[model samples]
Target: MFCLHFLVTSLPFNELKLGRRKYSERMYAERAKPLAQYTTEELYARFCFGRDNIKYIADLVRPKLQHKTKRSHVLSVEEQCLIVLRFYASGTFYQVVGDNMGVDKSTVTNVVKAVLVELASLVNEFVSFPKDDQMAHSINVQLVANADLIITNCVVKWPGSVHYAHILRESALYRKLRSNRPNGIILGDSAYPLLSWLMTRFPVANTPEQAGFNSAHCKTRCAIEHLNGVLKRRFACLNYLRVEPKVACNIILACIVLHNIATRRNVPLDDIYDGPEPDEMQPGQPPMFAPNEGQTGRVIRDAIVRHYFRLMT
Candidate 1:
């Protein structure tokens, strides 16, 4: 009786297998309807793959939220560097970067700021003014000994502005004057009252001829402008930043660091400003001044030109 019952059940197994095959065939036929008959929206919903794939991969790699715990999110030093590099290289918005990296936008902002602070510290380490006696010695040896004079640029601002313009001016002057030679003189344009102040502190190169010379100065001072252009071009997202100004400042500094690194490695800058003619200045505008110099200023000016030439070569 047990053998007879087993045989009856086994006989239905073949029928069940056939029924499954038939069902699968029916499903395939139903799915084979002409895709062209669908509306554009329906076709896109059904067949589009690229955007979905990107989102899917991003989702798959996204970090899971942790419950309140003792452990913190741990990012390694190299990973931090990569984050900074990608920010500078691609100029993607923070939200987009966060989406791609599977993190929050705030996390991306924090990573960039941290990277800038660290890099600024490193730049200060490698490039800095020499101290008291050594600074004096270097000034005498490098500037006074070889050059006719030194020209310095200065800018005036409210007492507590965070801009580095004033600090750079002071630092450059200190570095220049530390050498006890009298031959080097500092130069400044009209905007800097501190130029006169510096002249009183030490023998500086400011003269009536040097006043209002930035238009002329553009020939040589174009490097900084070019640097800024290179920065904005490479990272187009900088133009449309939606973050707070302080965060934007940090992002800008990080880009500067990356620019220096690329420059040191001899990477050529892309010229994004190569276009048709620029707009003409309107009537009544101040005439653009060219760098004009008397005998005293010329000697120092030539020295600067030569110095930069050597650096570039």
Candidate 2:
């Protein structure tokens, strides 16, 4: 039986020789697999997700508990900020964000919301609209005067609740602008309610001609849209969010703060517009506004924008 076993093993040697070539080829192919290319800075720039910001964000979100469990994961304020930024920039789902950050989906949701609440307070305190008379007047003259029109894009239904739109409008930033420019004429898309209640608050122009101008004017406001796109694209987690709606709202707010900061620091704009121009005046569509009337609003808005641009420059 031993001799038979030896003969059996030895008989396979001939077949083994034929298989060797296939095995070698497969091994070579495996070895030739392409390596991922990205340095830490490159990854951060592309993903907009930075470990450095984790500590700042974590501190903002950390609960004020007296006793802490030793086994608990200690997420820093900066990390929390990064998560929020990633969510807003990429619109990545919570589950995906958690997996990327090595945390559960629920944790990511909580962290993002908590961080936003905290940061929103900070943003209100520091990054506010022009309050002082001189600043407000300058903003009105420079930025507001130069633009042919003032367009305020309102997204009515965000993730969590219907009231979110009102909350945004009531935010300190928006309030400051509204109070300072009582006579300012603003334009919005059709989705928003043209309440008579708000008509006296500001001269709102929502006619078809005005809407067309607003759409054309969007190019100037594209900065915020780009900011949103950047946050989502950088963090793959935002692509498939599964967190509670409240948490998602917070994440969005936190990202807005980061976007503002980046803007303050003069972050370069991402050129994403390649579509046909909406403002291209159609033939036979009599110019929407009399040259003088249009010029008045344009002059005011442009002046406001230009002043800000100069300061930024």
Candidate 3:
């Protein structure tokens, strides 16, 4: 070669066009329309909450979330809540959510974290174990819902591999039921340990009465299943989380708080499908060894079967 390096070094900087590059000036974006301009259906489709319900949520968090500074282009609490809700409803990447909301990815992340913290604080007030004891896993969330599909109690901190019975055992709700106890029983599946306050399906229906008990118990327990389906279908983010486990836990709790608000306000489920029927059992659940099963629980289950399900036979 003819000394290529010498030729390149000899070239003038101006001839090489090595002058500093000029970047395009930053252009701020705006949503096509303000949130309030959207109709009820549009709000539900994008945010998974009706306009009124969103206003309610904004109001709930305003005391804490309202911007303290008078900085330019500061986001309002309404927009902040909407950003998080959109992320929850779409379950898409943060950049995508930011694009929709006319925000940068960092802003979206910050807003979600702030609004999630505010919403999660309301969980104790919005979600609790029903004193009436009419119940019911993943993160292994242990949810207890009433017949109305309202989530009464939820334990959200457990890992995915944790056993349902173990989660229940570790939960404060479990201790409360154990000590104080409720007149009505909570229905669970074979995956959970049977307890005096919790009734699981009969392992072996030795009699028609036992078979009938299993059938009715299974049917009635469908409420919790339905509640689970409704919850996931409504908040698509809960299907799979992209955040760290600690943040995911807070997100789950916040979603439950929002769910309770929607349910209480009769916000319609706008999803194309409500998912599978509530009566259908979730498939592929491996059976667990319930060493903690107690005779007291067996006696109570037998009493219910004798009194209620025996007649069906």
Candidate 4:
């Protein structure tokens, strides 16, 4: 007992203390410099995403992101935005955001949630199907004037993996297209099974006639694939979401809205020449849920192959 007490008392107060970082030290000593210091291009090189997007989002949610306290000053809307972007860009932890920004982790948490909620509110405006009597998807964007338009819902909440064919039958947009414009045609890749409303290329173009149809289909379908490439290129978060599925869904729509905003403002998008998202090799045969097309569906498919593609060629 005497020895224990002697050792305890002998220890210096500093030696016995825990090494927790002070809030001010963290706030003031952040290693990651404030992004606002950089030019827009410099900022883009840093986050690689979300920096260009903030200008559009700020007016929408900046007011809501603000907090003020007499006892302790709150993070400004701009500060919160920088925190949110840094978080998404790096997929770094809240502690990293705090240490880098000189804010408490809780502050970072609140800022992101507040901003997402505000962004979510404007989703319908930016992310909607064409309200066209007909439609399309894989989250392709159609630019009009200066805004990004998502012609289909971009949700991964659908059941069963491997892009099941039946999912189309159960899809809301599919039904919308059918009811609104039954005569309208949609071009799809072989990953999608053919239906009356959706058309796929000839599986194996053995004959010249079949070859012509596949060529026409490939040329048109490549454009949407290219759209996917550009969209994913600009937003790194879409390539690999760090948030929960629900949050990811909102983020996806939020990005679509912002993409359009960037377009309207004439902000340069990521160059397509930078390359596409790396593809994952499927380990096994893709599971199939394709049911037989109806007589009408087959007739429509054949007519397009014969009339449209053949004539176009």
Candidate 3, 38-141: lDDT as tens digits = 88998888888977888899999999988889965678888898989999999999988877777778888999999999999999999876555333311112
* Candidate 1, superposed: residue stretches over 4 Å from native: 1-76, 126-217, 237-249, 273-313
Whose lDDT is greatest here?
3
Pick out the ten consecutive residues of candidate 2 with the lowest summed lDDT.
26-35
What are the Cα lDDT values of the candidates?
0.39, 0.41, 0.76, 0.56
Ranking by lDDT: 3, 4, 2, 1
Mark the regions of model 4 whose C-alpha exceeds 4 Å error after superposition: 1-36, 47-53, 68-72, 133-152, 159-163, 272-293, 311-313
Q: Which digits, one per residue and each the tens of the lDDT, describe model 4 over residues 1-313?
A: 0000111224455655864433222123332345556777877654543454665556677666656555334456666667776765566676676766776676677777777667777766765555444433222212211113233454445534534444555566666666665445666555455566666666677667678877766655555555566566666566776677777766666666656565556656656643223222234534443455445566776786677556443
Looking at candidate 3, the ten consecutive residues that score lowest on lDDT are: 1-10
* CA RMSD per model (angstroms): 18.7, 15.7, 8.8, 8.6
Question: After TM-score superposition, what is the CA distance of residue 192 in candidate 1 from its true location, in Å?
Answer: 4.5
lDDT by residue (tens digit), candidate 1, 1-313: 0000111223356778787432222111111121324453442233221233323322322333212355333444433444455565566776665554445566677777766665544443333334434322111111111011111122222233332323433545544543343343332322222221122111232543343232334332334344445556755656676666666655554444444444444444446654322212223422222233133345555454444333322
lDDT at position 72, candidate 3:
59
List ranges where model 3 is wrong by over 4 Å.
Answer: 1-27, 32-34, 132-141, 270-293
TM-score of each: 0.42, 0.45, 0.82, 0.69
